[model samples]
Target chain A: MIQAISASDYLQPVHDGAALPPLEAALKNLCRERFRRIDRFIQLALLGSARCVAGRTLQPDCGIYLGSGLGPIGNNILTQQQLIRDAEIPKPVNFVNTLGSSAGFHVARNLGLRGQNFFISRRGASLQAVLGAAMADLTHGVVGQALVGVVEEVTLPLGEHRLRQHLPEDRTLAEGSHWFVLQPGTGDSRSLDLKRFAEFATLEDFLKSVWRTGDRLCCARSMETHAAKTMQRGFDAGALSGPTSAFHDSLEAAWLAAFAVSREPGTLFLVDGHPERGWSLFYLGA
Target chain B: MAGAYIRGVGLSCALGEDAESGVSAMQRRQVRPVVLRLDEFDEPLQMPYYRIPDRAELFDAGRLERLLPPVARAAVAQAGLTPEEIHRLPLFIGSSCFSIGLSESRYAAALAHQSETAIPMPLCGYQDIAAILQRALACRGDTYTYNTACTASANALLGALRMIELGWYRHALVVGAEWANRTTLAGFSGLQIVADALRPFDAARKGIVLGEGIGAVVLSAETDSANRLRVIGGASNCDTWSVTTANTNGKSVAAVLNQALEQTHLRPRQVRGIKAHGTATPAGDTAEALGIRQVFAGLPPLSVLKPYLGHTLGACGINELILFAGALQRSFLPATPGFETPDPALGVQPIITPEAAPDGHYLLNHFGFGGNNTVLVLEKTAP
Candidate 1:
């Protein structure tokens, strides 16, 4: 059952810097409008992922396989700068935050949900691992629910014109977090199911593939237009929804649909296609 | 987790450039923890380490952009490819200290008031290392760097194996490197963990003399063939213990190793050999040996690599694995270097000299800070 329900997100234009604490209120208001801020935006999206549960119980078993192409790279640089400024010793919290578990620690701290927290750091296989982890946990009954996400923030220097000039052409090169909460179910639980998922050696094969069929589909957090169009079967109205200056906008799309579903259970589809690895598919349903 | 395969391997260290030389040194039982004489740090501690010594002399400018750059470069280089190749070509890189040499240079300058306002740096810019690897290999598959002290490289290996079994990527490269840095001196000085000399599992073992080395491996699913070290499965778990000290009770380490064995669906008795994390410090060695005895009470013969090369920190996992693979290839197990007598403190007989054991399920174990204790089960390929 791999289908997108409805998607919603908060005012992401606000940076994680000085402007964050104030928006915490605006974030709370969105939960009614279909948004929730558990603590950090990282957890907020993860909390949104809890929407995958199609039942009445408030919670489900959660196993998270969080990935990042660059991770909190900007924050990592900032923390590194702080440590570098002093030669004698490093600040304790700064050192702890620099570890790979930085984001995983935030999600666990904010939600107090302890299932399996893995930070898969490979570039393309990131989503593959996240989706793959959920599937494995699903088989073993590891948890009642699972939240998988990709969260990343950048440092000012990394965003500076000097650095952008240094990057390659293929990379999306942005900052943001996208997450989904996948609740386990058997049978045709997905509003739409992922029929075929394979990695193509060449770009031509990826371009010729199909994603949508006989319905209006919106792709979030990707540049999968060529493929999505093929899936629409020429019915049209299949559009990509986000170039939200965030790496994980697809996560927002998943949550936004959950909020929209309060009116009626709707169907939206989300796909994340990294340049190297193929694509990750999730079956979501009401 | 099911079994994973190791298709290719790479290594860079003091003993030799490739696995063959490193293993030959081990078989001969000749180990020399290199002396650290870098004039940059404030502390003038006479430290002995297992380092290439002059890594600056080793790395030229354009090596990163080459194809199949000798085995050393292949560690990080091979992971760059397309969806078809990328599936089987994931990447995991671990370094105990990537540029401790640079860290030492900066620290040394700052100490001697030579650096002025020049800020000493570790890796100077983070992108330099990965960028070179990325530029050279061009395989945009899955790549990650793990720096969990001594367990760093093993964690990378564990991650690569887990992702593959989960069907994330079909293949992977786990690479580890260490640096000759001022921090190594300060770190060991601060803790007094370094021993008078390099001795592992020896009755008179004093402390660990920090060392530097680097290693890399290309692991893939095309195994059960000749040229593959079958990684059946592994488990990575936290001890939830103090950062500096391992749990004296050895409960978590025991649990972690057992979990890895369980993941491989292998009984404890099926494990034919072990490559222990014998760091040689009184607490560290006793702790690990006890953890080992807990799992394999009437255990198979155990071997430690620390005596061969000073602990390479994050690079230790790959370093140990290379030696283990080499020993298996040569049909001989290297003596646990400097291990003369089994410590009565912990009732265990560390393999003191080279010996042969049936090649079957070999367990590679590693432990690190933040309570990371990981173990892997490797089944030697049938010739």
Candidate 2:
């Protein structure tokens, strides 16, 4: 078992059919004051998150696991023209962004990670996949400290599709990027005991085992199935209420979980609730 | 590190439409990589690619309906696996562009206002490969589709290995299917990347060629009597210098190979004929040459499979591995069909004539445009 030394989250919302908000608007919302292109918004959120978590950790070998939704936003547009014009596939310049694990590469390279990086993209199971891969990489000595985040960049495809599909209003293209640093159990001076990293075959199991007695559950898209299951059990709003978009949404959970610290920290819990292929993940606060 | 086993395989390309048919021809050194005949976007290029037997065979119900929408049905069927079998294993589908081919055609059709005549689901639509699997196999277990340009399937295989290693699942179903589409042809045509049909590692190669079809295999931890090939090891790495182009120096490519070697706990000499992802493009051939040299240095003779299988983006990993193992077992490496002269830029040499099979394991490497490289080590197992 490992301990998350520190954690921080950043969220950027992409509305449907609207051009991107100003790079300034994207930057100003962040706890950090860094500026870059709107396209690099996910990377920026990750940078701030990694800094927040790593600042308290002492581990030297750190890696990153990124969960995301809609994958890389720009890649869609990059290949859009190719699709529109009926052109032969140009050299696939936009292919790089499609990599779910490589999202960490941006943060790692920016931070000179020069160590280990993995991008786990499991559509609805993004969070579960990332946390599992990150924790596994750490335990297996794949790296020392792991910086993880889930980011979602909404584009016309996500929102317009919801509209086209007539899904739900609040469910429209949600976005967030969450990151945390996990150190070896003894690496950091902080003490928080994690119960067990658990998985589920369905959302019902998650709610019964973890959220049966809880309220105000903070969830990302990865928590959808379980989120739905909990909602059915009178947990709260369904998938429409919580995080929208990529593994990036894990950031929103980190933010809410951090805020719960002053309340005796009964149990900082994370669970998928309802995953597409019957995959859900849970993490505990020691 | 963990191992996954390969069971039930599928292949389709310029060479043949099914595994049995294609492997039969490949075993005897009979393959014809053809330069497609189409418009400039379909503009006929002079590149050689594994012959696509006949597009009609792809539709011939006598043997075709056996395949499904986009190409999923065909692939799964060729594997001789039923929905029951697929539902039991995790599904990983790898492809560069799932169905850009049909999608492009439909886009043009819709553009021309030929709505009624348009293909209902332009390959990219729900009915393509992804939907087909979810529909046909009713596969609900950890289904993922990987799109990493050329190395799509290879990278997908990497995920299967990781999942298996983590003990998350005992069995995985990997699918790599490449079929002709207008976009694939256009992409290569636009960049002029297609060589006169891949003469990989050959001196006179101008570029690589494109092929299509499906490659499906079941990987399991328990290699019972059904196990055909054991996945000794697999690795994926990003060069990170250029998103669309390989870093050229091949540092990342070599690093992945070293990592795979370390995991499989096999030395360089343990591998025999290497299955080179020789797309046979100018930069591609060179990068691969340098990568091989970096990893093997004075290693075993390299055999090229693109000549028979062509390039099956998502399917290349499983597709090539299928043929490579069969060819090695048969002791016949297909000739460098169109190779007339060698390029100076290329680093290592490719086997010119079919050499007798040596006793040892083999290495297979595939590199995609987006800096993704995957290498698999396969050891011949006794029956």
On lDDT, the leading prediction is 2
Per-residue CA lDDT of candidate 1, range B141-251, in tens?
435655555676776776676666656666776777665554445545556666768667678888877766667777765554465467777766544345444676777
* Candidate 2 structure, TM-score to reference: 0.78
TM-score of chain B of each: 0.87, 0.85
What is the TM-score (0 to 1) of candidate 1?
0.72
lDDT, candidate 2, A52-114, per-residue tens: 554453343365556553456444444544444444354443433434434544454345443
Query: How well docked is model 1, in DockQ terms?
Result: 0.13
**lDDT values, one for every candidate:** 0.55, 0.58
TM-score of each: 0.72, 0.78
Off by over 4 Å in 2: A3-8, A14-19, A24-69, A73-78, A82-120, A132-149, A156-172, A180-279, A284-286, B37-85, B102-106, B114-128, B225-228, B331-336, B340-347
Residues A1-286 of candidate 1 have per-residue lDDT tens digits of: 3322223333243333223333345334333232221224344443433333222332412444565544444333344344334443334433343444445534443444433445554343344445554555544443456566655443333233123234433333434455555554544333433322454233334323542343234443343666544544533534433443433322443243333343333344444455454554443434
